[model samples]
Target: MILAAGQPDAPLLELFLAATAGNVLGAVVNFVLGRFLLRFEHNRWFPVSPANRQRAEALFNRYGRLVLLFSWLPVIGDPLTLAAGLLRTPLPVFLLYVTIGKAARYAVLLWAYTTLAG
Candidate 1:
């Protein structure tokens, strides 16, 4: 969408803000779902894999809440946020780190789009 907008005219700031806001909102929703699903952590049908869950937990334990900065990662990202909720990572900290990661990602994409389009 940002690239599409740039095909004609780029509102880079708007695109960045909108993308970052959406990413933050989506992660928060994931966090809420993770919090709500805490009861099912031990269930056999739990969506998250035991191995991956353990890995995310270990990373969180080692790095503390700041690990949320990597929540933009593809394979491990969602699990990281889920683990954050499961482990009771503070909302403010989660939002801060996640926003930074997501915004940085979008900023890079937007920059690349503009550079290529130009």
Candidate 2:
């Protein structure tokens, strides 16, 4: 979608807005899921083990919400957003960082595409 949006005739601003909005929205979903999932922490069917959860929480505490800046990374991005929610990161803080990261990612990609294609 992003690559296609970078085509020469594409409406850059509109495409950028759409891409960023969708990406940030997806992250929000992950954040919400993380928050919701925590309610099942003690349930037998909970996926994450308690020890693993504790270790993740410790790491999140060490790094803090700044990790949300990397929320555009592929494999780790989704998990990072999710972790933010699991750790009870403030929604406003999460949105600010996540939006910046996601928007920057698309902007960079578009810039690179336009530069190379030209």
Candidate 3:
């Protein structure tokens, strides 16, 4: 869609910028949905238990803010953010690290995509 919307031979830099923005917005949406899961009385998808959440919290506690840095890793990122919400990690702290981590991931992805295309 993006490519079709732009010039046929659009520059790589433009694509990188556009993709990075999209990725950041996607990360924000992911975080919002993760937080919303907690507000629900019953989440059918992966019923999160307090005990399991406690264990996750303990891991986060040991890791501290570093947990956010690793929050963009595959298989681990999603659960880590969900765990953050369940553990009531401070909103500001969560946002800061998550944004950084996700942005870094996006940057790496965009760079690789562009490099591989060349």
Candidate 4:
């Protein structure tokens, strides 16, 4: 989706907005899941183990919500948003940081594509 946005005839601003909106929405979903799923941690069906949960919480606490700036990252991004939910981060704070990170990522990618390909 992002790469497609960089096509020569693509509507850059529209694509950027669409991609950012969709990506941020996804992060919101992860955050919501994490916020609610922690309640079921004791269930055998829970995906995350207690030890892992503690470790994730520890990392999140140590780094704080500022880490949300990297929420645009691939492997760790989704989990980071989830951690925010688990830690009960404020929704506004989560949205602000996550949006900034995701939007910046797409902006950089678009700029690079234009610069290199133009």
Candidate 3 regions off by >4 Å?
A: 4-46
Instruction: Give Cα-based local distance difference scores for all models.
Output: 0.83, 0.90, 0.68, 0.91
- Candidate 2 stretches greater than 4 Å from native: 1-7
Order by lDDT, highest first: 4, 2, 1, 3
Which pairs clash in the backbone of model 2? none
Q: For residues 36-116, write the lDDT of model 2, one tens digit per residue.
A: 999999999998999999999999889877889999998999999988888788999999999999999989987987888
lDDT per residue, candidate 1, 69-100, as tens digits? Answer: 88888988887787788777888989999999
lDDT (10s digit) by residue, model 3, range 1-118: 3563235465656666566566556555666776777776356565777677667768779879668777768887776776676667777887788777876776786677657765
Tell me the TM-score of each prediction against the true structure.
0.78, 0.88, 0.64, 0.84
Error of 4 at 4 (Å): 5.1
Looking at candidate 4, the ten consecutive residues that score lowest on lDDT are 1-10
Candidate 1 overall lDDT versus native: 0.83
Clashes of each: 0, 0, 0, 0
Which candidate leads in TM-score? Answer: 2
Residues 22-71, model 4: lDDT tens digits: 99999999999988997998999999898988888898889889999999
